[model samples]
Every structure is written in structure tokens, then in C-alpha cells.
Target: MNDIVDLFVIGGGVNGTGIARDAAGRGLGVTLAELGDLAQATSSASSKLIHGGLRYLEFYEFRLVRESLQEREKLLAAMPHIAWPMRFVLPHHSGLRPDWMLRSGLFLYDRLGGRGLPGTKRINLRSHPAGALLKPSFRTGFEYSDAWVDDARLVVLNARDAEMRGATILTRAKVVSTTRHAAHWDVEVERDGRIHTHRARKLVNAAGPWAGKLSETTGDPHRLRLVRGSHIVLPRLPGHDQPYILQGGDGRIVFVIPYEDDFTLVGTTEAEHHGSASEAVCSPEEKAYLVDFVNDYFAHPISTDDIVWTYSGVRPLIESEGSARSASRDYQLAYDDDGAPLLTVLGGKLTTFRKLAESALERLGYGGQWTARAPLPGGTFDRRQGVAMIGRWMEAHPFLTEAWARRLLRSYGTEAETILGNAATAEDLGQDFGATLSEAEVRFLMRHEYARTAEDVVWRRTKLGLRLDAGQVAALDAFMAEARGEAAAAE
Candidate 1:
């Protein structure tokens, strides 16, 4: 009776952490348990855009697109370091949708979000800088605005903010089972090979692709259409900062986004995933599909050999009768209060996570909406100050390379000072695990960001995996293992 939490959230993806942060900020006692590291699942595996799903306009999902557009702007203003605007170039394809239809869609997209972002405009691809990489066949294209985000970092920042607001965030923890009592629910969590029980006034299941399986514990027929979306990272395409929205002839759209400064991210194929969501991966066919799709638009064709890294994530869309490509990206909140309140999030997009959280809390009867204006951790600075902040950091730490300083600032924002601490030189930052990744940053992640393993650091917390060799990865793994051992011995 004494150890009761007001809200217990399962899953550490954007939705779960977003809900926990919102609830905790509103003075509700919250506990969030993640089966693995934060964002280790579908959250980090996203295409890394805080976009409005412009293509959804074709599917007549006006509400979803409009809300996502609004959320995109809100997130950019709140966390400029991790989320910023990027223009998408949609080349004209005479064989597919007509140019007029494309223009009409862009027009609706521009007007739908209340004109906060740059309006969509036609571009002469033959003359623009973006044209240089594209084929001559793309004589004309339209450019529209959308925001890009560090998806994994978004999850971590939300979880961190929630903790600061007094929510207990447990990584490497799983809710083994739940039992509804008369007025509350008993949640059994397995952490570090030990089981602990806690009571909660309400329980939230934001388990992404695993929502269906987790809902089985409640004896509900929670069906989800598991769709696998995969991405491939390649060496930077020689061109502008703008990304591309490639329309495949097969009625699917693919995105070629600029990623991590030196890479271009190309992705997202829609295929029904049948097995465990955890086992989802970019199949060879998916890779070929993406490569072929992108090759259609770019003058320089990309093959599977050009791919630097590939990742796949399962999307748990609400089950409906349609092809995977036509499935709705809109989210659904199912509430059951026959006993204690139980909220299960069915499907959602990364861009509208905050909105989704607000809805979830409202459904749970938590009072007031408080997250709309609040900035995420280290995100209190004005959006215009992102570049200035980096410059200031570089000026203060003259020992850091411009590239290194920028990377740190972009990743940690104002908190970069905390990570850099009093280090006077690169050597003071501790062992270099290659690609500018040092023990200092690794320790910062481990201590503050719930990074527990080398893969967590390289793959999720940072994209240094794209640059580090296998030997360097092994070195990092050994270093982290030793560091954990030392921490354990000290304890």
C-alpha cells in the first residue's frame, strides 16, 4: 500500500517516455520500465524525421498529417539541437502522379499546418544545386519543409527530463506480468535478473510493436499490423542539405535523407512482418528494393555495396484490411477501467509523440496539459542559439577541434559543458575509442543517458558505429566492461 506509484509506463520508446515526462511534470508519481536501453527498439530505428508524412495526404489522412505538422514545428522550437527543419525535394514523375496533383498536395500541406514553416515551392531542378545529383529527367521538382530529428536522442532526452521531474526510469527492466487488484494494479518487474513488485494506480502499455503480446496479459485481443520499415545509410551524396522524397513506381514512397553530417539515409520499405518484432531486420530483398527505388531518382545509382549500415524497425499499426503501405500511421489509445486504469497505445508516429502523450494523460484523467511549452532537457536555449552555442563552446574549449566541438554540442546541447567538464585537452577526455568517441562522452552516456553497452553507445546513443572499425568497437566494449566492473567493485 505504501509503495504505490501514480503512473507506471511500460516501454521506453518516445511514446512511453513522453507520457511519463508529461505525467511527472504535472506532479504525478511515475515509474517507467524499459525492457532494454531507451530507444533500443523501434524508436531509434526510425528514418529520423519529425515529418508530417506528406504522402499520407494521398491516403486522405488529413488529420494525422496536420497534427504531425504542428508537432514537427513544436518539437523544432523546443529542442533545436536535436530537431531542425529540412527541405524535401520531390522530383516530378510524369509516369506516376501528375505535376498538378503534386502541387495541390503541397499546397494543402503548406496551408494545413498554419504556415509556421516555409511554404512549399516549385523548383527548376535543372538549375538548382539539388539538381546536380539528380537525373536530367527530373527537370522540375517541388521543395517542402519538414524537420529532421535525432530519434534515439529524443527518447533519451524525454526520459532524462522525466527523471528530473521525479519519474523513476528503469533501463534493462521488463514488466514480467501485471495483476489488477481492486483499486490498483501490481506490476512485476525483472531487473538485473531479480524480480521486484510495485503497485500503480494506473498502468500504461506503450510497448510499440510488442503492444499486442503485452496486451495478451490483460486477456484483450489487441491485434496490430506489424510492418517492417528498414533504412540504409550510405556515404554522403555530393549535394545540398535538402533531402529527397522518392516516389516508387510501385505506389510506395521512399526518403533519401541527409544523416550524421557524412552520410545519406535512404529507406523505408513496407512489408508485413510475421515473426517477433525483435527479430525484424532489413532483408536482402528490402535492401535491393530501397536501392532500386533511390536509383530511379538519383543520377548516380546506389547499390547494396554502397550501403554503410542498414537497420530495420517494426511499426505496430492498428490492424486493418489493406496493404501495409496503406495502413494508417494514426495512433489509438485503448482505455480499460473496469478495475484500475489501463491505457495501451496502439500505433503512433515519432513526430506526434507529445500530442499522443497529452491525449493519453487526458484519457487517464490526469489534469492539465503542461508539456506543450516546456523544453526537453538542455533544450531551454532559443532555436536561433544552436549555432551560437556551438561557437561559444568552441571558443571556450580552444583545445577541441571544430568538428568535435560541433558534434558534442549537437548531441548534448548546453549539457556539453557537463560532459566536457574541466578537460583541457583531448587526452584528458580519456581513451579515444576512435571517431572522436572518448571515454568522457561514453561515461556521460553511461552515467546520465542509460547507455549500458558498447552497442548502446555506438549504435543508438551515437552513430560513431559508421566510422569506428571492429577493433575499435571491441576496445570500447572491453573498456565499458571494465568500467562497469570497477563501478560494481566500488559499490
Candidate 2:
């Protein structure tokens, strides 16, 4: 391991990876260490929508809205395969809010974002197909723009880009201690039961929910509010590819987004969490609450039995004086009095990760004004025109299965060809799992995406765990164990 680095970032969530990518692009020597798999925390458990936070307008968060809006469009074009556009239908319950007010909100959302995604459109609930699943009491609604992101993939792609730009990304590596040595920080990274130390001119605590704890390690007095957000997945809603944003009776917004091909994701409950971020679990109460909220707004209600999976994430909110929901989602960047130059990132949303990272790098005095036009990994291709590249890759590998080819194209874009190389058939990709997962793809992820553990491979690199059975996971685990042994012997 390199003992000298320009910047050391704690946390492997969206913010940390984004900062690493941005800083690396600006020619800074960077290293990012994560105690667990990337996105194992809040990054993967997001509502998975990238928008301007239209609801934020009511709170008068104009700056957040505008920044998020711009970032949304930039990220959509930057990583089209893992992220794409989706329209959201806001169904108005006549018994609740009026259509004009909803229309006004949509108007603000449309204009606030100069995003190319089409503006708001009024819809007749009785005539629109989206209305068929809604309660009869809802007769009017509006459809507007937003984007759905494969949240985990976003982190992995960013990490990959940073590595390509010469940043060292170490997953399953914990930063257990740090000491200030005059103008720099001596950071300790623990991996494989060994402690590796490095010196960084600047350190960033972008550990999301763990930011507060990381600050304590450096002996900073700042504390953060760890709020838990939970989500539930249910059997797919018929023809529910587009997402729906509904206003809960409690005046909060709950998202019912189309999930994997056969599931609908509904979430999230916000409550003060006083637990470990890595061990956060979705409580039965949260699942029930989400199911009830969705059922109240829809004709086809989902119950506990309908649930497929549930996940919970801790939002490291900057402690303030109000309800956790009202607690500001605005991020804070700090340089404590220690002079060791630690930048602690607090309170950020998935939509603004790229911008949040850019700001973090600027604060560290590394980039100053560079990387405004930088692209993420595989982002060199015009993402909006990704289909053409997919066509070319498919044409080149005619013997490959469509499902397998599409999986690579959508997840890695044109970079999939690099993995495919001269392979001409399924045999070229090696052993196949029940899903499109293959030995070739797994090796590529392990070599390029910092996938060191089964969780990283199964959960982050691919969502195959949701589709694979327990037995399949066991097999993958055994395979990983053997691979780890071989890797250790080689070293």
C-alpha cells in the first residue's frame, strides 16, 4: 500500500466515491477506504429517484432544488445504463388536496428543472391506465419528470472511474484510527487482519451515517442525527413501470416506484435511529406502515404476504431543532479547528451526490476549479444514445444470449465489450448461475469494481441475491472462499 496520498476519504457510499472520482480526475492522489461493501448502507437503500425534490419547494429550499435539478440531468447523461428517465404520476384524491394546487406544484417542478425530461402533463384519472390501479375516489392527477437510478451501480461505477483516474479504492477495509501530525493526517486502514497506515495531506469523512463516529475518531465535537429510512418491495404492480409519488395522510410523501422487472418498491419511513448503520434492519412496523400507506391510495392493496424484500438505511442528518422529517437534508462540510484538515460530509441526498462530492473536493483545496466537465466511468459515451452502442456490441456477439448481453450493456454500457473481448459464445463467458451472472462478469467485477466479499458481488455488483436462492448464495460463497485463498497464496 502507498504510504503517501494527497487525500484520504472515509466511507464508500455515493458521496465518498463521487469525491474520489472528482478529485482523481483533477490529478489528486486519492485513496478511499470502506469498512464494508460499497453502498451496503444508505446508498443502496435509497428511494432510487433522482429529481429536484419538488416537495422541497414547500420548505423554501430553492438552492437544493436547483442544484439537485441540474445534477439530476448531468448524472442521467453521465451514466445512462445504470440510470435513466422515468415519469411520475401524482394522483390527486379529490377528498384531499385540490387539483390546482397539485398542478401548481408540478408547474414549479417543471420550470425549476430545465431538464430535457418532458414537463408536466395533466391526466384524466378515469381515462388513464395509471388510474385503473387507483381508488375510484381519485379522479384527477398529473404526470411529470424524474429519473430512476440503480443506486448501487452508481457507487460502483464512480469507484471504477476513480480507480481508472488513479485513485485507490479499498473495500472491506476499515479506518480504525487517525492522528494529526501537524499539517497532515496519519490514517490507518485495517484489511485482512492487517493494519496499513498512510499519510494524507487532507482527510474527508464522507461515511454517511458513520460520519459522526468518524469525527469522534479524529476527536471532533460535531455530532450527527442518524435517522433510519426503510423501504419494502412487493409483487409488481401491473403496468407500473412508471413511478408514482403519493401524499400520505400524514402530509409526507411516500414513493411507489417500479422496482426490478417484477416488483414495486414502496418506501420510506423516517424516524430517529440510535443503532449501527451497518446493522440497520427494516422493522415490521415500517413494512406495515408502507403497505398501509400504499393500500390507502391504491385499489389493489398489498399485505405482508405480498412483500418480497425489505431494506433499511440510516440517514446521517445534521442534528437540528425539529422533527427528523423536517430536519434539513442539506449537507454540511466542515474543517474542524484541529488543523489536520478533515472534511466531514453531513446530510446529503442521492440525487445531489455528484455535486456534493465536487464541493467536498473543492473544500480540500485539491481541485479548486477543475473537473467541472469530468465524466464518470464509461460516461465518455453519450449515455442518451447508449442503445446504438448496445446494438453494436450485440451485433459483434451474435452467439451470446440477449438477456446476458442486455445485462452487460445496461450495467456497464460499452465497457461490456471489454469484458466480452473475443468471446463468441456462452462458453466464452464461463459458468452460468441461474440468472445471467457468469464467471466472466464476476471476474471483471472482482478485478475492476473492488468486489472483495460475497455481499459486494451479490448485492452491489449485481442484485442477483434477490433472484438467487439460498443454495446458490452458498455456492457463490464457497467459490469466493477458494478464490480468496488462491489470491492470498499468489500474494
Candidate 3:
């Protein structure tokens, strides 16, 4: 729209925003544009683990598992508010893999990439609290440590950090076209029905499932394996906070995680996606597959009727010769600088987005690995400080419920203070949208987090959608629409 920037990133997913944040922090001008809300796709649909892909070891993805393991510790340390350690229980299935194999794999997992988490140990399920929930036949199991993260929040924070570092962040903006030039590239982006043209010395295509399509804009044809992964959320199991990793007859593994505060998150089936990513959904067959698998292990049985919600996302995996289940989650960068500089990110995972960004920038001829240690926006405190911050907020604002305070702290971290402001009581929050969603928090998300819709706030920014009633959601939607209209009129 104005001066030529150093880098123009297409796609506001984890990789695009991460590269923009990295490039901007290194004194390079950066601009990022997304067609929709950040992390509205695969980034938010993950199984929500920051593990080393323990199952990846069987496929001999040692390198990926190692890198992921290393990132787990870094991310856990960097953002303790939205991320924390979770213990996973893997029950032994002699019918699938042998006990010796499981033990050996666990050993390698514990030693790989400087394990900061607890080592694996065998347990008697019958005696363990988690075991009581399982069938009596499942007598033995193993427990190990991994972390859970708010995947959508991770993308948003990166974008926020990038904007603070002088990158132009545009949501609901689509890259209409791009043309190569001698020293730069001209890009046209459509936002609010207006076409804005800009110039950049370098262009990056990190469009997730749309990367291949974006590459076509540059006259390069690239294909990726679009694997649809789907997850189902059930009403929370009565006891235990720990999650389970169950093996299937087909050799694939499914995770049954503790989701939100009152739900069990189970998934996912990896089937080849035939259509656009936007149309991906949990097929009826996949639903039956998951239900049957879980029923095979747990004492309490559930059918599709028990599922409260389901989500699906298409992963743009590097095309490889194998079943979609065995496809590589590793990413590749295709750099073409024949006349104008262009770098297209082929495939990537949520855990390795930072390293992928650094590599992308280095290929674009940028300097330094500054993002490795830098904290994300609102992530300046250590784990102890995070707990203390929550305690202090609860102390100062005695009107706030413990559950509300904890949720806000985990979602916004220290920025919750800004949203709380000088409000002495709950009424100052303006309007109560139910499920602890106050108007103050909604405005905070709108003002800073690029949340333009109630779905953006309820589903992605916060999982409060699961708790809100239908009428509450409709009211929130109406409120957001009015607020957006008012803001547009003012502008």
C-alpha cells in the first residue's frame, strides 16, 4: 500500500506469522495477510499435544521426533500460561505390538533430544486411578510426559508479536495476485472489498493447505498430500485429568485427551482428503472407527450419540509414497529465485513452526536466530510468575471466581490485567455473555486478537463455545456484529 517491504508473507497460520515475527524482529520490514481468522484450520484441529510423536518412532521418524521433543521443552518454558505438562497413559496391547518393543521405544523417546520430561515407567492399570476407568483385562500400562497447548492462541500470539515488532498484520485479507519483477514483486491483496497493491523484495507462501494454490500464483505447480485429521469431543469422563494413547488394530494410534474442563477429546482418523480443506469433516465411518476403538479399551462404553462435537482439518503434508497415515509430517521449503525471490513452504507441523521460520528466513538471506529465546506477546513470565500472577489477580479482584480467573490467566496471561483494568467488580465487565465471557474480554479480543466474529472468540480464541448455550451464542454473535458495524461507521 505504501513503501516496498522486505518480506510479504501469505497465510496467517503458524509458519507465516512466525516468519513475519522473526523477519520483523531482525529489522526487516514484513507484511502478513490471511484470508480468514488465524488458525481457523489445521492449526486448531490438532490433538493438542507438544510431544515428540512417540508413535513416529515406529515409522523411523527419529529426526522429526527429536526436533519435536526439543521444541516441547522450549515451548513449555516459554509459554507456561497456555501450555503445561500432561501425563499420557499408553496401555499395553500385546495383540498389536509386543511389550519389548513398547519398552524399547519408550527408552529411545526418553533419551532423544535432551528429554526435559519425566521418563517412562510401567504401571498396573488395575491399581492406578486411571486404570479404574479402563476394562479389567487391561492390566498394565505406561505413563510418560508431554505438554498441551492452545494451538490457535499460539498462532494469534505470534501474529500479535509480529505486529508489535512493526509487521503489518492483515486478517480477512486475501492475496488476489502476484507478479514478479527484476528487484521485487508486486502483490495485490483484497480486504474489505478494496484491492491494495504492495511491493516486497521477497515473497513467502506459507498458506497451509492453500500453499500449492498460492505457488500456482507464482506460475509454479506444487502438489501436497491433503490428509484430513478429525477429532470428536465427548462429555468429560467423570474421573482423572490424565489422557490416554490407545492403539488400534490397524497399527494407528488415537488419543483420548481431557478437553476444556468438562469434555474428553478423542481423535483422529487420517484419511486422504479429496475436496477443499474447508469442506473437511469427520465422516460417519471415521466416527464409527473412533467409537469402536475407544470402546475396545474403556470400561464405560460410548457411541456416536455420546459425541458432543467434532472437528476436522486438512494437513498439507509433503507428497510421499505411502498410506496417508504414514505420510511424513516433515516440511520442505521450495526456493525459486530465478528472477524474483520466492520461497514456498511445502509442509510443516505445529511444534516445528519456529525452526521452520528460521530456516525460511535464512534461505531468504536474513541473519540471526533471535526467536529461539524471545518470549511471545503476553508470555514474559516464568512458570512460577504465571501462577503468582493468577493468584495476585484473584486477590486484587475478589469478585472474580477462581475458575474465571484461571481461565482468563491461561487465555490472556498478563494481558488479562489490561482487560480487567480498574474494574472493582464483575458489573464493570459491561455485559455477561455467560460462561465467564464478559464484554470486556470480548472487546479485548476484538481490539487486539483479530477476532471479528463470535465464532472466532468462542471456538478458536476460547473453547467457551462448548459451555455456552445456543441463545447465549446468538446474543454474542449479535453483539459482535453491532460492534463491528459501529467501528466501521466510525472509520
Looking at candidate 3, what is the lDDT of residue 305?
97
Residues 1-491, model 2: lDDT tens digits: 45778899998999999899888888889999998888889999889888788778877888988888888888777777778888889998766667788888778777879857899999988999899889898888899989988899989888888888899999889887898877888888899899999899888888898888777878775799989999988878887867889887676789998776767889889988987887888898888888889988899777988887888899988889978777778898987636778788888899888888888776776546544445556667776566677677778877766666667767787778778888778678887766777778877887788776667777778777778888877777777778778888999
Task: Please provide, for model 3 over 70-130, each residue's C-alpha lDDT reduced to its tens digit, 9 standing for 90 to 100.
Answer: 8888888777778889889999986888889998999899999475878899999989898
Span of ten consecutive residues with least summed lDDT in model 2 = 366-375
lDDT of each structure?
Answer: 0.90, 0.82, 0.90
Instruction: Write one digit per residue (lDDT tens) for candidate 1, span 1-491.
Output: 33999999999999999999999999999999999999988999898998888889989999999999888778887887787788889999989999999999999989887777889889999898889998898899898988889999999999999999999999999888899987898999999888999899999999999999999996554999999999998999888478999888888999898888899999898899999888988999999999889888889887899998899999999999989989999999999988988999999999989999999999999888988857887777887877787787777777788888878867888888898888878888899888989889999998889888999999988889999999999999999999888988999
Report the Cα RMSD per candidate: 1.2, 1.8, 1.1
Clash number for each model: 0, 0, 0
Tell me how far the alpha carbon of residue 441 in candidate 2 is from the true structure, in angstroms, after superposition.
Answer: 0.6
Measured with C-alpha atoms, the lDDT of residue 130 in candidate 1 is 89
- Candidate numbers, best TM-score first, in rank order: 3, 1, 2
Any runs in candidate 2 off by more than 4 Å, and if so which?
368-373, 399-401
RMSD (Cα, Å) of candidate 1?
A: 1.2
